[model samples]
Target chain A: MENQPILSVRNLTKKFGGLTAVNNVDLDIYPGEVVALLGDNGAGKSTLIKCVSGVHSPTSGRVTFQGEDVNFSNPIEARDRGIETIYQDLALANNLDVAGNIFLGREKEKSYLGGLIRSLDDKFMRDRSAEALESLHVEIPSLKAPIETLSGGQRQAVAIARAVYWDAKLMIMDEPTNNLGVPEQKKVLELINALRDRGVPVILISHNLPDVFAVADRLVVMHRGQKVTEKKISDTNSEEVVQYMVGALDDTRKAEVVG
Target chain B: MTDGATKNIKEPGKNASKTILLSLMQVWAWVFLACLVLAFIVAVPLVSGSSVSFLSVRNSQNILVAITPVLLLGLGQTFVIISGGIDLSVGWVMSFASVISALALRGAFNAGLPLPLAVLAGLAMAVVGCGMIGLFNGVIIAKLKVPPFIVTLGTSFIVRGMALLMSENTTVIGLPRGVRNYGNESMMYYVRGDGGGFYFFQKPELTVELLRRMDRIITYPVLMTALVVAVAIYALKRTKFGRYTYAIGGNEVAAVRAGVPVERHIIKLYVLSSVTAGIAGFLSMLRFTAGSAVIGDPLLLSSIAAVIIGGVSLFGGSGTVVGTVIGALIIAVLTTGLVMLNVPSFWQFIVVGAVVILAVLIDQTRDIIKNKIGSS
Candidate 1:
């Protein structure tokens, strides 16, 4: 029972008109584990996570989160149910401030006399958002400037902090360390390890093998929209994982191609 | 160096400079607009040899009074403009409202309803009618995903044609006195003469006539314009709807990912724009005492010009209604100033065009300067 996955997927599939972006893949994430998904470009890593995070609807599949079967129509629905996705671009409005980006749709409202006049409780949101950033060890000098001014790594940290602040039980970070410089990249890797230590499950999808090896407990590799292999970091090396991701026709995929 | 020490050495200085730069950009737009208004006020008196006393109470009241309808339309235009959209048809929509409301009130009074109630009904009908046109503009722009410029421009022509068809291109007259009074009413502080009299054109000035002249003070239309601007400021600055509007305008895809109902907010924005146009029309109809299909013809260009000149970006997402109101003043006062100084009427258009270009030029320059600073 202790080894059971916290979130389970059964034969998840997603298609865009004539093409199936993600084809019949089953994956699971357990609490206190960092599962790294490895794939080349267009290998459906993002699509599979989008389906689970409610950015896209699956064609046919079952997603069981924390032991309950659920369907999320949008990100808001997925977020409410304790699943959060931080896309590659971070999906933050550049015109708004740090607190605003964090609580864009979920603003705290002030209520009077049993919920009469409800306006944004701006002071509360500002203070709490500062607290949230502090918890994640993100040191933004000002919370009032637009998010666009922040460095790439700082932006990534804010995105991660927003998810954590919302009580996300499972974070699907797509390309979390894609374009960061060495120092920033190191900070993000440290952040992931810190998140894992706090007992939150993370599904890190990236091509950066060293970073994956540094944090991920389990590695799930996909190729041509199909799961090629799954391995524990202790059992295999990054050199072996690349063989599965490169579509070198790992024995399992070759079986499907031939049969 | 240790990793922890390296992390401790953060770039707080760069962040502090950026904060100052960002705040400056926001405040500069308004400061620049105020300077434009001030420059005009000061220059007209010096340049025109007092043909226009640019800052006199009566003259200030005149500019405010004349700009009432314009300021109203400018408020709505600010909303549309801020949301990364433009509504070109608002001018004709106003004309449509004026014609419809004028016809309704006159007909209602003729049909034996009390004059005040009939006037109220007519105003209500005008607002409702214009709001519908806005809704039509909204549906096509939001759902059909047509560009706002084309959708609103096409809708403006259709509404203009409808207003003409409603009156057969005639100017409706004999409006109810109450409706007309709304256009004409004003408040005044009577400056009682201290028994001083002067001769004018070889005749002695009578104190009774002087008191009567003093009795007429400031007009109510200025106050009305102030109220509209105030309400617009409140709506855009102090509400949830406004925040969502800015978010959508700034980055539509980001707003959607954050769960803001983008299409719905945009539709409401269009409606707000048209309803204000309708209100402006009612004001103009009262002031002019006639509602013609062509009454709104000049308003479209003036209001849009005012908005752009006020520093509201055509690209959307960064401007204030307060800036917009000042833009309206600049245009209205310039027109009045030119006419008073006996400048050719056609020259007014050229100056307005030049001012619009200048405002945009300033905006782009500010952006470039900030970018240079950012990189350095």
Candidate 2:
């Protein structure tokens, strides 16, 4: 746990005109650990992750990945640097097949006529995509069916497969298990553990408390645009975490002297 | 083990049959076209009592020639519609191209340029000039955030006025005599002259006997259109450009998030649409040996109708160039067949309009069934 942090954020803040969505936040994510980010609605959980994922630029602060400061202007830049964020919507093109979504931004091509013409290498992509899904023990009956036709859990597996195939160093998932059936939620929890075992750190933003308790090594709770408390899994229970989530507990203020 | 078993459950027999049915539905237009041709063949013999053969080579050539321009227009529309946009200015874009090409050709010929060079200049001006107009439409819609419908409609009116003003409201004529020959020349001619001679890749002199005996006509324009169609099919099905077009249409927000350059792609689609329209205009100009401001006016709606009839969704996301080809053929056959039967030409409009609605209804029903199968 004392090894160098893979990602670190210091004094990060984001403001939208008159409102402060995220304020002066400091966080660090170490390698090979699942860190759950728990917060109630409008607690800036999504905004904080969005800033780190390059969806929005922080109003002020610094984000360091692999010990180098990064200011990503778009999601692609962040993804190229080994940061994969699965948004709440999953970011899958509904009309595309599973393999197509897996290779959405970057596609494989076979060139002909000394590079004059390049055609999509769909066979290679499908084979590789199948390998990726198999490694995760995810079963999809058809890789050619459009994403819209897939069940919710299957879509989530495809998104996770994309991150794995790309060898993402850091995974940020927002409410990944939401809207999923109970069995599907268990599958996702298992997948998070698999990612951690492979030494890829994950920052999971979820409202599901039992899921956090089941898979996370540590937890951070945010309340009203501020991180109120962070605790080891053994140090805090769901009741105490809920207290921090609803703004009933404050660790930063407790450290401030009453002078 | 339960997780693996639960997810791996599949009914192979049902899924396999469903996949076959789904693919057949996707290609229903081709089936519809085959049935149409068969019906016309049967009706023509019954009505005319073997006098006018509907399946004759000459009539087939007529239908093929008639569809070239409309097919070109529909090719471009297929791309635009698949990318979730519309280009209403395509007809005027055709007119604009015709005028520009005719003017360039006449100007170059008067300047003592070689005949081939003059023709090349006409083609270059027509294609490049219309491409510029396409670029204008793209920039306004993508950069200024204008709705595609409004932007293209506005450009249609502006281009219409420009074409009328440029041509001074009359047909532009006075091209070289050879220009007319280029339009009518076929690849091979069989002449009954000299005791039945076959002229390969050359137009033999049209004596009364040769005119009466000639049955095979495979023009250069037809070959050129074939090449374009082949290339268009390859591009839409196999290339990154086609995939991106579908992705943008399917869910623009997801495409953008995936780092697809949406605005740049949109601009390219418009440019491609206009270029095809330009080609159609240039071909028609060659076919007529004259350019009229109103040449493409009636064709604008027909082009869109062809695309709709081809199974392309107006809402975007799914379509194929092959489907468009069959759709154009359907309209061409209907128009030519109606004239052969001596029905009023006005009936062509009502029939084509009705076909458009029918095609869309079938497409909608197929989609509903597909959804059901997908979910089940």
Candidate 3:
């Protein structure tokens, strides 16, 4: 999994008029490690992910995926290249069922006579969606149940399943455990670990230090639109991480090693 | 992990059962049942107080003529409403199409052209004009970001003004004989033996014309309405465009995020609505054999009201073409029944207004119930 970094961002910078939202940050996410991006609000964490996810193009710098520099015009292009983002909102249509939401834009079709008579392959979709969810350990009662009926944690699970189902190599989750209860958060953490076990690279963005400590293999701290420090989880404690996140860490703090 | 897993398994099953129960009690089910009963009740008067011989085939034929155009217009309105937009210009578009066709037949444009070509010209004019108006509405909503209500309302007045100007505020008459024959034809009949005595009577009895003049009651427009309904149902239920319409109407922001070309799909929906209006216009022209600027005035409100009353959400998404057809039938039956009951025309308007209000109230109640169950 560590043979090559699947996604590499070099000196990526984003500015909104007068403010520097993300200032010359570089990152390399490997194929299997779960990297937790930690920062307080206004710390430019979201801006960095947004740039990588193609919601916002970087103002300057290169985003190279699979060893090739690519510019995504929109999220669709990013998704097509298997860079799936699970936004905090999940973005599932509440009126549609789990399978419907999973295959929202990229719906499967059955066609005959040179695509003249087209029909939805509902049976195939239901079966495949069930297989995907079951493989992910997402215990959904019915694929036909509307998304609005699901709990927050279940919804998050469905979102992750959708991303994974599309064969996304790099999964970016933004504040996934924000409003969830303790058990729900644990479930998400378990799912993240399961993803890493399956050789999927995960980028988890969170304000919760405990969640980060529980799941992340490595930590990347941002302070005022810049990468303050990057460290392996075994080498850093919560206090040292918070210090780096808030821009209070000294040079010695950056040099400290625990591995 | 075990507790969380157990809770998750328990909740979805409960929620699914609740949803199934709620849908069973939906107001649409009741409205659908009510429409069937009303249809039966209305038919009773026509069949009662008269011998089997007293019922005329022409009366049944007249009912079909009155309902066909409205049904077509209702179909167009259903599409627009389901897409979360309204088209008020359909009536005027129909009038414009009919008047232009009638004028064209009178050598307004082509000299000695065949009737079919003239009719096609009328249809094209209606389709292009109404479609443009609809396109304009969609552009304003998509690009300019104006509300659909205001855009369509403004276009309604503009279209009516155009229709009036095109016909010179006068009725265009002298339609071609071929076009006139469509409305004049009757497609159905009832046969009865004509005799004054029983078959075994000792004395011979004089013969009477119990049934006569069987004309085709079902016209081309009526068949067209059926075709339109069938196609609409298929398109809305089976096609990607239909699914996207529901998705966008359900949640526009989510749809856009999902990479749906939101603005383009909406524009197409508007275009489809107006094209249907154009078709309805041509059919109405054929029915009346003359086109007046005032031909589609009542239709503007009636068609929209029909779709709404039939159960298409005024808020958009989650509607069926079948519901719209039922809605059109409801309006037609109500109007015809009122006339049969000798109810004043003014009273009929009052009753329709009441029904529309009731339908909307029922829809709102259903939504509230759904949200309650969903949240729980």
RMSD of each candidate relative to the true structure = 4.6, 2.1, 5.3
Candidate 2: lDDT of B121?
92
Predicted complex 3: CAPRI docking category? acceptable
| Residue pairs that clash (backbone atoms under 3 angstroms), model 3 | B186-B215, B186-B216, B186-B217, B187-B216, B187-B217, B188-B217
Residue-pair clash count for candidate 2? 0
lDDT of 3 by residue, A1-259 (tens): 3688999999999999999999989999998899999888888999999998888999999999988898998888998898989888888777677877788777788897999888777777788888877777768766787777787888888888888889988999998998988888888888898789888999999989999999999999988888888899999999999888778983334455542
Q: Candidate 2, which segments miss by more than 4 Å at Cα?
A: B1-8, B12-24, B190-198
TM-score of chain B of each: 0.85, 0.94, 0.83
The lowest-lDDT stretch of 10 consecutive residues in candidate 3 chain B is B196-205
Model 1 C-alpha lDDT per residue in residues A1-259, reported as the tens digit of each score: 4587879999999889989888888998988889999899888988898888887889999999989998899888998988988888888877778888888877777666897545666777789888987877778756886776677777887888888888889988888898888888888887788788878899999989999999899999988888888889999997889888897747575677899
Local distance difference test, candidate 2: 0.88
Q: What number of backbone clashes does candidate 3 have, counting pairs of residues 3 or more apart or in separate chains? A: 6
lDDT digits (tens) for residues B292-376 of candidate 1: 7887778788888888888788888777888888788788877887776678999999998998998888778777766655445
Residues B1-376 of candidate 2 have per-residue lDDT tens digits of 2353226356678777667877877887888788878888888877877877787777998899899888998999999999899989899989888888889998999999988898889899988999999999999988898999999999999989998998999999998878876666777776543656677875666767667877547676777788999988999888888889889888888888777889999999999999999988888888899877888878989989999999999999888998899899999999988887778999999999999999998888778877877667
Model 3: residue B207 alpha-carbon error in angstroms = 14
Comparing 1 and 3 on DockQ, the stronger one: 3
Summarize candidate 3's per-residue lDDT along B1-376 as a digit string, tens digits. 3444514334657677656756754646356546644654656466553332212445555566776767777777777777777777777777776776567556633576677777777767667767787788789888888888888788878878888888888888767767776655434333434432222212122334533433354567777777888998988877777777777767777777777788998888877877787777777877778877777767878887778887888777667788777777667666766665556778878978887887788778777777776556
How far off is residue B78 in model 1, in Å? 1.1
